[model samples]
Target: MAAEFDTLAEWTAQVATDLGSSFKIPAACRGSGSLAVLDWLIDELHLSHGGSLLDCGAGMGGPAAYAVRQRSVRPLLVEPERGACRAARSLFGHPVVRASALALPVGDDSFDAAWSLGVLCTVPDQLALLTELRRVVRPTGRIGLLVFVARSSEPFPHPDGNHFPTEARLLSLVEKAGLGIEDWRGTEEMAGPTPEWQSRVEKVTAELADRHRGQRAWQLAERQSQLIGQLLADSTVTGELLTLRRR
Candidate 1:
């Protein structure tokens, strides 16, 4: 097990290697999709040079790497997962700090902006995280966030059954933190789940279920992926991207 404070250099190497760039895409990662997650942030955030940033829940340094590549940005990343923190530091020079979203270690007015992608819903204390986010930003600094809030059609809550605040409610939570939402868009994939992945998952799951030990392992991996695919299938489950300026 990796400690929270450990530098993201030694824990996991696989996720780090996956964070590489394709020269064809101008020294950017192109594997995850046609567009990089970092590119996505840069486009939406539109940050300028000398923009100090805090990236909460930066996974394997994808967005962090993007930030550095874009404008020589040094994003301070916060991650509780040791493997992820290791990946962030190893893949990108961004400093990886072992910190919980609810209680950041940085001082007030320490950052020009804060971003946390794909991490809000599973957080146990949404309000706490928002408050902490508000604390770090200089007055008028913005928070660019990509969060997956639950909708009625979703199933299989967090493995730990954490709260999944709805998108509408999530904005209110941010407002409570003293930042007003400046952008809102809900992406819905009109089509349902793809047959190919669903079929493959069902077959693999049943096969593994025949064995007690294998069933548990397979269920965790296969079931979770299936659930994620289902919810995100039509973008019925969507991300709320907010550029909120701190008040």
Candidate 2:
């Protein structure tokens, strides 16, 4: 995945420039697309210096590394994927525990706060994931989540066969999980899909197709990005950030 590495390298450089920090980001841990929103979510957590945070679906550990270095928050990354778990340790020496979000391996009240980036929508059992998040974090711990939700009843195709919950369904799940809503808002006002986002998706799609014509991961990422772009363009899907506190 030369293209993936190249894109990540470029983005990391830009982030370094914008933030004025020379913290090196590993390419293997960088997720696709603009990660500008990551900073906002980190800020939402209001983590104190040297506090611990749980990173649900911690992919590649790039974000975890950045969190530790920049935010000064000790992060425990939990990722189920074997490759990603290894990459996190190998690339950044970030502490990683291999586990599913539905059932975190850590003990109860283990972290000061927790956050998940772009992972909640893909889970088939959102309530279970929410419950687990509540379980692992301490009472009154803040949780920051970024997800894409259905703007209408229209079905959106996803590679993982997961459906986006409506606003009401999400609220119900939050209540069921015993999480108090600290804040909820649409991300469009803060960061909507721009031409640059579309261009980057297209570039990544083409690169994936050229590199691996028949690979499932390549095909899935390409198709998912296309559908998301379409849904975003038509306003059928909305990106959201939710802040919750364990009760």
| TM-score, per-candidate, Cα-based | 0.72, 0.78
Superposed model 1: Cα runs more than 4 Å off? 1-12, 15-40, 153-162, 187-222, 234-236
Error of 1 at 130 (Å): 0.8
Candidate 1: worst-modelled 10 consecutive residues by lDDT: 23-32
The C-alpha local distance difference test score for the whole of candidate 2 amounts to: 0.69
Over 1-247, each residue of candidate 2 has an lDDT whose tens digit, in order, gives 2222223334333433343322335333333224455666677788768999998988666677767767889999897766566656655677888888898998999889998876788788999999999988888688988778887766656435446888888889999999988887677666533565444444543444565657555455556556777877787877788889975
lDDT of candidate 1 over 45-101, digit per residue (tens): 666787888988655555666667677765888888776676555555568887788
Clashes of 2: 0
Clashing pairs in 2: none
